[model samples]
Target: MAQKDGSTGSRERVLAAAAAMLAEDATAKLSVRAVAARAGVSTGSLRFHFPNQRALQDAVLARIYGHLFPDEQIHDRSLPARDRLVNCLRQALAPTGTGQQARETWTKAYRTYIASAPTEDVRAAYRAMDQAGRRRIEYWLTVLADEGALPKEDQASRVRFLSAVLDGLSIERALPTDESILRSETETLYTAVDCVLGGA
Candidate 1:
């Protein structure tokens, strides 16, 4: 019993350490050695809990999503499905602030993942983040579909389209745009939602 409790505690600590590393630097490589060092645990212990880098990354992403989204708004049946989805997507974008902050965010992203060839670890980190985003969108769409508010077919295409719209809007946020950009972004979001839900 004591051994089991200790193992659970070690797992929690490792996950917390990994999450902290990601919070500090979004592109940080979550290698077993690094995470274990951060957690003050042995590499064997981390591997016992997480098995691999992908497993650790997925667990951390799931934890972050649970804290950020919480499913309350997504499952709120009072609001229209489109509204719930749009709000969720907006929540994802809220981190990329407007004006200067957004510009800095974009600059960092470009330097980290776009300007030059990324290492294997960097590529894996980016892919994990991207997959997590897609999974979150797919989960929201699935809930709406289950509620009979959205079509169940072509979910992959719908998620991809919405994600593309979001990527474009995020880039727009960083650009030297006018004040009406926010309003325009919201309108674009609504249109995207309508297109997906309406199956257009």
Candidate 2:
């Protein structure tokens, strides 16, 4: 544990230091001593905040998830459910073309998280996120079913399958910086929807 000379809680300071380290080195090299040094705190203070390595790792994982999939309000109700689904998929899978540096940083962070999977806390975080996504997918499937574009009884299966497809494609697209390949991935979402909905 470490204690900071300045107030504002040593745990927060330690988490901030860990996040900065990840930003710089692409993954958390979060030893208590290293984090304390970075935060200008004593090792005992760090322990007070996070009793063990796993506790610190859990915080880091939570921060990473927050950075990657931030909560945002979507206001556009005019678009069809299918179109909205496509739009969400595109935004999630494609780089927004803001700048190469920003995209590269995101790519690096994403890869690091992927490589460190199976942590219990991380798995729980993933499940919560996945459940939210599944709810949205089920909403879209219900809309399609109402329009006779999808079978009523197939809602769960279609949503599950589409969710899996989207998850796999996202992981694949994260592997490379090729814009063409990413574009292909976005297009594949449309194809997947078409196939799942019986190819209208």
Q: Each candidate: what lDDT? A: 0.83, 0.64
Root-mean-square deviation of Cα positions for candidate 1 versus the true structure, in angstroms:
7.0
Residue 29 error, candidate 1, Å: 20
Q: How many clashing pairs in candidate 1? A: 0
lDDT of 2 by residue, 1-200 (tens): 43355444667778888878755654344788888899889888788778886567557646654566454112245765456667765665554333454457457656655667778766655565666566555555554565666676756677788888877765554455547765676678888867776743
TM-score of 1: 0.66
- Give the winner by TM-score: 1
Q: Give the distance in Å from residue 109's predicted Cα in candidate 2 to where it truly belongs.
A: 7.1
Please provide TM-scores, in order, for all candidate models, with all chains considered together: 0.66, 0.46
Candidate 2 error regions (>4 Å): 1-84, 92-119, 177-179
Best by lDDT: 1
Please report, as a residue range, the 10-residue window in candidate 2 with the lowest summed lDDT.
Answer: 68-77
lDDT per residue as tens, model 1, 1-200: 33745998898899999989877766577899999999999999999989987678667766776687676477788898889988988987888888889899989989888886888877977877776677678777777877888877778899899889988899899888657887999999999999998852
Model 1 misplaced stretches (Cα beyond 4 Å): 1-68
